[model samples]
Target: MSISRRNFAIGLSALTLTACNSTLGTTSNSGAPKPKGLPADLRPHLNRDYAAWVASFRNRALSQGITESTLNAAFRDTGYLPGVIKRDRNQTEFTRTLEDYLSIAASDERISKGRAAFTRHRSTLEKLEQSYGVDAEIICAIWGLESYYGDRKGDIPVISATSTLAFDGRRGSFYEKQLIAALKILQNGDITPSRMTGSWAGAMGHTQFIPTSYQSFAVDYTGDGRRDIWSDDPSDALASTAAYLKRSGWTRGTKWGRELAAGETASRVLQPQAGGPRFAVTGNFNAIKRYNNSDSYAIGVGHLSDRIAGAGPLRTPFPPDKYGLTKDDRIALQSRLTSNGYDTGGADGVLGPKSRAAIADYQRSLGLDPSGDPSQQLLQTLS
Candidate 1:
């Protein structure tokens, strides 16, 4: 995903932040309510203005060389997904500290899953590394982060998603371009419109490539005629990611970076968190950034890659957050809260919305201010 599209997905919901894809489907365009098994926010909402916008967009798409047949097939069942617009507009600006990011990105579960995925796909990944000169673990790490190793390759139809965003007009031009690219992909017979499902932002497949990126970098590594990334097999998606990284200047043999031990020095060093561990990075680090363009994202990929390759967690501890709660303290707070009949949604140490809501409920029950901030004071109170 492009930085703008990826950032647009941030903070809308925990699912959007942590998982790029959902298996939910939208309601049909027939104006009949159907049980789609989707959350209310994710269900399609009818809008006349959206209909009008799509009508106008059809002309523009045709002018841009999208075939009429392709347009009709793509839009036959597609409708304006208000949930997509809600996700786009409701993105919070909160930036996670590197500590919080790593805690989620390289969590024990994610690391374990990455290793299993790497092993499961070892033959394919090693071949990709040989063919593309990008690290197999790096590709696997990207897969883990993008769509949870293909567990959540999303189920939202791409035409509906991209067209809805293009009509919403927040980042109209960009999404319009993406919409056109998606149409092109459809016209090229890679996949049918119904099978072309992806994230709400139209980032598709195991590695979550937006339509434009897919057009530029997606490949048919399976030797199949189609560049099918949304399939049960992840070979094409993984190969596409490797190709993207190689084209983005990944050095053939250099490591992305490593957590710097005491007395270690490098020409380039990054300390994304003030008192967190520093990393010695290489040009390959920049290459990883070209995929997502966030220091934390790149570090998360590199660190997760290292963990998948049998490396351990960072030795240095992160300083306490602004609320004076270290990661362990936060984890304990969450664990205690959950035990006390409040669901903090698992003690991952990152006090996300669910944990905060649980904390606020606990505080309110005691007639304390419902400020959701976690602190040592709160930890002690819970104790």
Candidate 2:
């Protein structure tokens, strides 16, 4: 059997407590010992520290030419949100497999909705295509995928998330630059502070755009003089996404590849899989990849966009060797392999090559097939 088709695809609180008993204070001994507790090194960093980091960030933003009013307006009283950190660190939902991902991301319902949106906004999409040289479906698919056609723009404050990342020091420089860019967006008046809420990772707007992307690729598609991706009006966000694709070399007329009906003989040719998926890809496919570097993501977007435009499911199946297992069996087998110390990155039930290798190693240890194909029998033995 083979698989295919498509695939498709925060809270913070602060408390200040002050002991204010005049009589008790006078009665207490002057040399009362401080309470014994673990040192600051053992404790997590405090939100107050985040406030100080933000204070320093003011200077950094000014250095980047963001006005003080915008800096104060956006950054004032903002603190490190622990929920944001939790969300960013645990990005992938634990149970989401590649197949499951495609099921939701490239579902028939979404494609149908997207096609309707393309039709409803045909004039806007056509103008965008003419101006940006990017296809309407590509833009609409990205919009639908990123935020469900703008129904769910994120709610996390950009300043808070980016500031936390900047202070966390793991990728401080990268996040600090993003924080500065966010402030600049505020200074430019593209969106009000109240309306500028976004993802826990600070990607704002209908398209989940980072601050730099908003600055560089966003457009005033409605001619309202503001490149407002955060607004209820999706014209700007949709157009911005198209602009990005165009600038990234989107072919005006090329399709983003289709699933190939490769024969069994093609399975023997694994050497050519280095660049991308085995399916025949086009320029538009690579352009989508530039938005998100993952090949799986690009494939999902491309396939979903095609489907949205009335194309049906993939003409060919993704060979079993690709995942080493079908969707139904992947989760249980992946769980067994992961329990045995093979970290397949996740147990999302999609058997990518790593999961296959893990299955093979487990089988070899158990004196069974080493061909790396997962089966119910193998899963049973592992369990």
Candidate 3:
């Protein structure tokens, strides 16, 4: 089984951080409701209604064996976060092309950092792979992607962020449950609430495990009697990620997947975009997907791992997107569209919503399907 929708931090972190965003809603792709629930009209976090909800939730936490000390410590400075709600609501609705995604996910800088991390942690990482059957380079790749080799674990307070999301009533149920799991972690003394900082969506520590996922997969690799993922040491976090992949059915010593040549074929070839680069994935690729369901994310991790392990870039060129516009072509097309009274945002060479709208409007003028799909024919026609 693959990692659930809630565990896709790799995909979620790529948003542009626009102020006005739409919430992912209380339900995710699996149609499961996220955890939440406070009075309907209470929007700002840490208000009276939110406080009341927290009080009520405390009872539930106690029922789950979270201690009083843990609750107090967690809720002491915990308050509602409107900023988190903005991020939750403002997530990009569309997926990026695999090439676009990997530009950041496995960029030159990230790859370099991944190699450094691999070198620095080789001893511990090799032992982890030996114990868990998950590749050490793959672990470094995840660590690099999640926290930039532990340089950028987020600083948002986990209790406040998760509680705010829970009380906000959008993905409230999911956040609520994560908040509870967080409390359990605190109760177990694995990490203090003060140090339980992470992303707005509750993904924490160097490996960016969501709270519930942390509970399920985190281990005390340092043998310190606690699973401390928030500390400076990334051993526990990396080990936990390896453990996650191991349990998700990672195949020992197998490559995650290989990028295909122009005319190559494999039994499980996955070509996400028709003209883009293709891959012949293995069960290990599927195992990577168990960490994040998106093909781009799995491919990013797999490719980055390979790169860190001294592999080269993709062998084949990924033709143009379905748009039939290469990145440079898209920039030129956008310039043409603007001259033709169809304003795409800024000719950034990426087809975002504004670009699509412009394409759609242009298509409408041409008496076409108005599907907003760019093609060579459309580019030629515009020319």
- Each candidate's TM vs. the true structure? 0.94, 0.69, 0.77
Question: Any runs in candidate 3 off by more than 4 Å, and if so which?
Answer: 1-5, 8-11, 15-46, 321-383
Which pairs, if any, clash in model 1?
none
**Whose TM-score is higher: candidate 1's or candidate 2's?**
1
lDDT of each: 0.85, 0.65, 0.77
Worst 10 residues of 2 by lDDT: 13-22
Model 3 scores worst on lDDT over the 10 consecutive residues at 16-25
Name the lDDT value of residue 356 in candidate 1. Answer: 96
* Winning candidate number (lDDT): 1
lDDT accuracy of residue 67 in candidate 3:
86
Cα miss at 133, model 2 (Å)? 1.8
How well does candidate 3 match the true structure in TM-score terms?
Answer: 0.77
